[model samples]
Target chain A: MGFLGYRRPDGSVGIRNYVAVMSSVSCANGVVNALSREMTEIKPIIHTEGCGRGLADIAISTRTLAGLGKNPNVAAILIVGLGCEFIKAPGLADQIKPSQKPVEFLVIQENGGTVKTTRKAIEICGKFLDYADSIKRTDCGWDKLTLGLECGGSDALSGVTANPVIGVAADWLAAQGGTVILAETTEMIGTENILARRAADPAMGEKIKSLIRKQEKLTKDILGPLAGLVISPGNIEGGLSTIQEKALGCIIKAGNSRINELVEYSAAPSKKGLVIMDSPGSDIFQLTGMAASGAQLTLFSTGRGTPAGFPIMPVLKISSNTELFRKMEDDLDLDAGQVLAGKSIEAVGKELVSLMEEVVNGKQTKAEINRQDLLAIHTVGPAF
Target chain B: MQEQINAVLIHPSDNVAVAIREIQPGEAILGLKQKISARQNIPRNHKVALVEISIGAKIIKYGETIGIAIQGIEPGDWVHTHNLKAEEI
Candidate 1:
């Protein structure tokens, strides 16, 4: 059995056909949000940084915006900008032009005002969606799937059930020649040695180890002893203490697959297999990075449960326990709690793969159906 | 063969098990030899030491050392922030 997806001009397959309405800077967010509210097919990508920042900050903001538009799930893009922002709307559109997707831009200051820009953006989006609708879904090979693995509100059961079970599914997808992205750089602190050992070569292994060391040192330097309290209170209440325990549970979601490459935040993986993305531990931030990096969907495991999903793709929620699954039936999609009930990890993992097939074939997850289209980009360095 | 699984020894070499459900104090943990009794109220999803561990000894879970015991812990003692330091605070 194969999943139905739309093949893009760049040779990437998209599970969802969406037209992105994005703000080049925080100033254009209102117009982007207005357009998103008018149409279900248009996803609004809003963020706070884009202008009046350091060079590094501006570059990351620009790169991330370009990546958002470049995501395979996005069929076309409409960039909304304030004329004076450092990251220009037309320039960002130019970055995505290589994909040969329909791209348009409007500047609020260059036009009459917010009202004029909103109207022009809406008109452009209408055409983009019409073009997107004409593109047909074809049955695609499993190798086309690029999955993002994440876990939040984690507990002990997350490691014992959800994470490990999701790991099985991740390994299965990688074995089928699909790409699996593992994120949360902070969570890699305590388990660096184990992960580094799995790297493709000694240099890649050193890279993994060095990245962990730098992230740990940076957090400690900034937050002092508070850095050790990396795990949330919910995690503690759910029986995890110290960054090490949470890191241990968090690493399992990547499965037992070897680390193929380490990519920077929001950067697409050039190779397949288990690719580690250097992203922060925040759920929405990491989810956004993964989506921007070209993951068609996400496999998010949670013990405490979260309702957040990405703006342009499906986020399949797997609950660690039967109780949370029962409580959040409206938000969660799969139940790894069966693993706790004596079912094998392999069995639940197979079930997860079938669920992924259903999702790729146009089935909306609970979060998608509820329209929990949350998004956030990782920003480094301070805005001036 | 399966008995009531109230706790899970994640790895064969693990010296601790996570409680699947809350185990009340003094309840005999079934499916284990030597008849270990819950020394205190072990909450659901929390770890319980399977053997007496001396101070500074490593606390093993998932067959890896998650932390070190800050104080001496007896079998079935709830191993958490109080008794175990995630690696010497």
Candidate 2:
């Protein structure tokens, strides 16, 4: 099951070769984004944090930014900074340099101002892009792929169609010895029992339960007894009522594969098969965390429609409603709404798996074509 | 042959079923081996009471209790945020 990909020196495989222009803090986002826009190969990775946060918050931000640059899909990285930021640009570039990818750093303050820094950043990015574009795609095995599973803007048909279709794909990929990481710890609130039964051992089962309990406690601590109402007006409008009801529907996306391990946000998986990453239910944060954890690609299922995409990984959007699919054709890659229209789940699932194989072999997703690369770091605290 | 209601009946214990499409009031909903008229204009994704429910009874969906009925619900009446309050898990 070898597909055309860029086999990185670090033993990871990437379907696309992208030179990322990463901002170390919110202050440098405009410079990075502008620099990336000037060069076709350089993509901007922007976030809202990186300055004046607590040590724990800064660590999370720094680690997440470094992880994105280290992602195999990124052939090179340009770290942009406002010299006084808490997460130093030079330090972040140093962390990713070990990946053997070409890395550069630009400080706005040191460069005099935004205009001067933007020019220097673009020139550096152009050089990185030139170097990155020279890397050729080679044949890579399915086992080298780590797929991320996520669902957002869900509706009633989510559980009955799109989610299960991805579940089937996840199960198939897992059986083939590839890795699948399911995120959104909040979505697993009430479905712990079902997920636990699929755990490789009793200890893993307990770990899964504990993760759910931790999410419950975190929400309770923030919102008190009415924490269940966190599903919000949107979920209710989409037909979801309780967290338990949403959790039950959400868990259907994980498939029936054995849970091999549980990993923290942005932490790389130790084993293959199915792994769970503890992440907030926020769509962008969840997707970004998975990308940070080394997932080369992500399958995003949405019902009401979301256009979020990552700079490094290609997002395959699957829609459960055919109407929404047609309405948002530019943002969606696959439509599983047929399953809701009486088509068998197996048929749609098999088709989706083939689509993933195509995507791995260089078939550009809708997100790529639309140039919808939305990048954000999961910051833990507010800036001063 | 009559077509079954194009809706998801989440739980066997539930007295309501989710509507997948708009159903005008008085239209016959074909399912559960019974023909029940819609008590009101049920919008897509909204719940319809399958049986008369007393106030304070849990509103079950997805084989789990989702909320509690804020008022008495007649069979075929629409159940939603206005008539149901979120239940603590």
Please give the range of 10 consecutive residues that has the lowest summed lDDT in model 1 chain A: A223-232
Q: How many residue pairs clash in each candidate?
A: 0, 1
Name the candidate that leads on DockQ. 1
What would the TM-score be for candidate 2 when compared with the true structure? 0.80
Q: What is the lDDT of residue A279 in candidate 2?
A: 84
Candidate DockQ values, in order, are 0.35, 0.17
For each candidate, give the interface RMSD after superposing the true interface residues on Cα: 2.7, 4.1
In terms of lDDT, the best-performing candidate is 1
Chain A vs native chain A, TM-score per candidate: 0.95, 0.93
Output candidate 1 Cα RMSD. 3.8
User: Model 2: DockQ against the native?
Assistant: 0.17
Q: Report the Cα lDDT for residue A280, model 1.
A: 91
Across A162-226, the per-residue lDDT of candidate 1 in tens digits comes to 98778888989999999999999988887777788789999999999889988988888888867
Model 2 residue B20 CA deviation (Å) reads 5.6
TM-score of chain B of each: 0.91, 0.86
